[model samples]
Target: MADGPTINTIAERAGVSIASVSRVLNGLPTRQETVRKVMAAADELGYVRNAVARSLKSRRTHQVAFAMADVGNPAYLAMLREIQPVLKAAGYRLVLHSTDAVAADEIDVLHSLGERYVDGLIMSPLRVTEAHLRMLATARAPVVIIGSVPEGTRVDNVRADSRTGVRLAVDHLYALGRRRIAMINGPLDTVPGAARGAAYREALHDLGLPYDESLVQIGDFYRPEGARAVAALLDRVPDVDALMCANDLIALGALDVLRAAGKRVPEDVAVVGMDDTDLAAASWPSLTSVSLGSAERGKAAAELLLERLRGDAGEPRVVTVPPRLAVRASTAGPDYDRRQSGYDGEGGGK
Candidate 1:
């Protein structure tokens, strides 16, 4: 194979020294005439800058790392899609790291900061721990968190208002005359699970509905776990008219269980989930869900990291993305009966 064009050839064509070409390619300060010459030469030679050498010289790889709890989750994939475009627009590449919701793996990424492999990091840890806090306290590069950190922590954070998301689901269920509402939620230790559980209780109190311990079941944030939780929930509260799940995966499990038990969706029981993931739409009776703004939150976290990389400000920022209720076929069945009662619609009225 023929050898590719070199910096020397580019410099000769541009009538400038190799050093000037290097400066321009590395985005370092250079004279205007030199920059113009380098660009013209690069265009003529069809030369691409050697990223490896440039990274070595400047100590910046022009890449950002994104560490997530669950790479397989559609919500996380949605966030990745949003984050990739924004980072690409800013002339940076992405490095994805799936931590499997493991604290050790997350901390490993943070420690990798000293290697200077990436300019910044955006992490979404499922659970915050002391080790996570310690890593953030002295992180080598700019770090933006997509989940909740400590209240007074000095870091940029973008969080979904999951509390509001849960409330939206509960309130929607109540409006549908679902007084016997049961919750099949994830474990209470995780950030989202804890926040959503608290919001469920608060929303019931606000709606003047009694909080029944018998109607709640805890599961891990997986389909099988959700199915088991629903099984337990139904065994105890057979009259439950509505089910609120902490996430789409759990809701899907609940749907499977309900169907297996010969129950009709929305007619016998209305089901709602959080996150508004693609699975919610693809289910047999498409699930109504609360949007936690996962994609928007990812974009915000990326923007915050970019701003820090550009040295825009010194203060830590907190961004909260609002949640919205997405109504679909699962919660739009005939049992609601509002349309027959002169309620003026099949859709849930505001």
Candidate 2:
């Protein structure tokens, strides 16, 4: 293996630039044609990634790993989009892990720190458990958490204001003369789920609106389950005037069901969603949503992790990104004209 082919060799054989060869080797985005050509060349040369040797010689692999709950969720995708570029610019290759929102899987990722396969890690665990804290306390490498951890966790942390984000969306609905507003939320056991659900009730109380137990439905964070939850809510609360979805995906599902049910958005029922992802602008009538600064949080997390890698001897830092409201056509004011302000739904501005 000492005489193994180098990236330049693969580039020459593949008839591509060294950078292209590196990109393909690192699993970065590339055209299928380029990928195929590079793969064939590597196969013919019997070349493999030399991460082990690189780590041994440098004592710092110049590699980083990001572990999160779901790959398909736009919020996490937004984070990855931001995290990837920062690490890339800092000369760190990134490895990704999708832990399926499972605490055990997340704990396993934290424990894998001992292997030193990479220089550092960025993890966004769905639920923080005692096992997670135990692992963090003894982790061999620096770590950055993209979600909230308890006080005194002694790790760099980046958090979004979910409680305030949910409040922003609920207040928007209430200001629009929306009474009898219903909430379609995710599992209340998770961090974001519990925080948003409790914030919704608190917002209602502040508005003097009665908190109706019949107005809330719980489901997973994906589209299909969100659609079903909306369907059930529609059946139970036919006269519901507004909907507050926990995230953009669920709001998208609510929009689908509302359109199919002959309910005019912002007229029959105003809708608001959290996590102002790109899907919000792409949806019909556009979606009004709360922005928890996913991109900002990701960038901040990368910066913090890299700071530790650079031998920062400071105390652990905590960064809490502020939230904003993105008001689109979903909650268009009474005077808003769809014919005049029509959108193509191309850029939701996540």
Model 2 segments more than 4 A misplaced: 1-58, 333-350
Tell me the TM-score of model 1. Answer: 0.79
TM-score of the candidate numbered 2? 0.80
Candidate 1 minimal-lDDT segment of 10 residues: 48-57
TM-score of each: 0.79, 0.80
lDDT by residue (1-350, candidate 2, tens digit) is: 36888888889999999998786666555554675677668767875335423333346557798998989899999999999999999999898889999999888777756544577999998688889999999888899999889899998999999998888888888888889899999999887888889999999999898999999999878888899999999999899999999998888999899999999998999999888999987777788899999999999999999899989979999999999999988898433434335533454322
Off by over 4 Å in 1: 1-57, 334-350
In the order shown, what is each candidate's alpha-carbon RMSD?
Answer: 9.6, 7.8
* Candidate 1: tens digits of C-alpha lDDT, residues 186-295: 87888988898999999999999999999889998888989999998888888989999999999999999999999989889999998999888777677899999999
